[model samples]
Target: MIIRKATHTDIPSLVILMNNFRKFYQQESNTEEVKSFLKERMDKGNSVIFVAILEDKLVGYTQLFPSFSTIKLEKIWILNDLFISEKFRGLGVASQLLTRVLKFSQETHRHQVWLLTGNDNKSAQHLYRKIGFTNTKFKHYVYNF
Candidate 1:
């Protein structure tokens, strides 16, 4: 398996994986919208995406968006998305992708990386804890428009 940053050439395969990810979260599937959203992010360089390829096939991916931490007075990363194909699960693909993200964050001198997962996602929570991420005391809240 190989882990690397995603390029424009990767958008097609990425769309499939991203759609699957959304489906897992009970979101509606819209390939056209997914394509457009990914294209915009890639074209604008607004986010960092990494892909995992196994035997020449895209098997997994993770995406991170840049943000600032006012308390730390430094840049931080929101690890927004991570998904491994069902067949590729438990093969350490997710770990490899996350390792790459953390390495990139360190290289860029970011203050920290933050991510949230549903309480029911035990597998993901386990992997994240194994990777040295700790549960925070603060609660997260969002107001939908």
Candidate 2:
């Protein structure tokens, strides 16, 4: 498997995975906004995307958004999205994509990386733990209004 940063040319595959990610969350939206949305982020260097390719096919991806941490007084990243195609689930693709981000954070001296998943996603929780991520004492709540 090959792991690398995403380019504009990779948008189609990225959009596909992102749409799947949303579906996994029980959202019904399509990839309608992905192309232009990702283009803007990529063009401005506001986010980072990494993909896992096996035999020239994309099977997984991780998207991270950069933000500052007032508490830590430094820049941090929110690994806002991660997805591995259903067909590639057990192939360690998720681990590979996450490891790339972990390495990238360390190399760049970032303060931290954060991500959240559904409470019922036991498998992903296990994977997160295996990757050195721990459960926080605080709860996450979102209001979509």
Q: Whose TM-score is greatest here?
A: 1
Candidate 2: give the clashing pairs.
none
- Against the true structure, what is each candidate's TM-score? 0.98, 0.94
The total number of steric clashes, by the backbone 3 Å criterion, in model 2 comes to 0
What digit string (tens of lDDT, one per residue) describes model 2 on residues 26-139?
A: 988668786778889899998999999987899889989988888789988899998999988998999988989999998888979999988899999999999899987879
**Prediction 1 global C-alpha lDDT:** 0.96
Q: What are the per-model numbers of colliding residue pairs?
A: 0, 0
- All candidates' lDDT scores? 0.96, 0.89
TM-score, cand. 1: 0.98
Runs in model 1 deviating more than 4 A are none
23-77: candidate 1 lDDT, tens digit per residue:
9999999999999999999999999999999979999999999999898899999
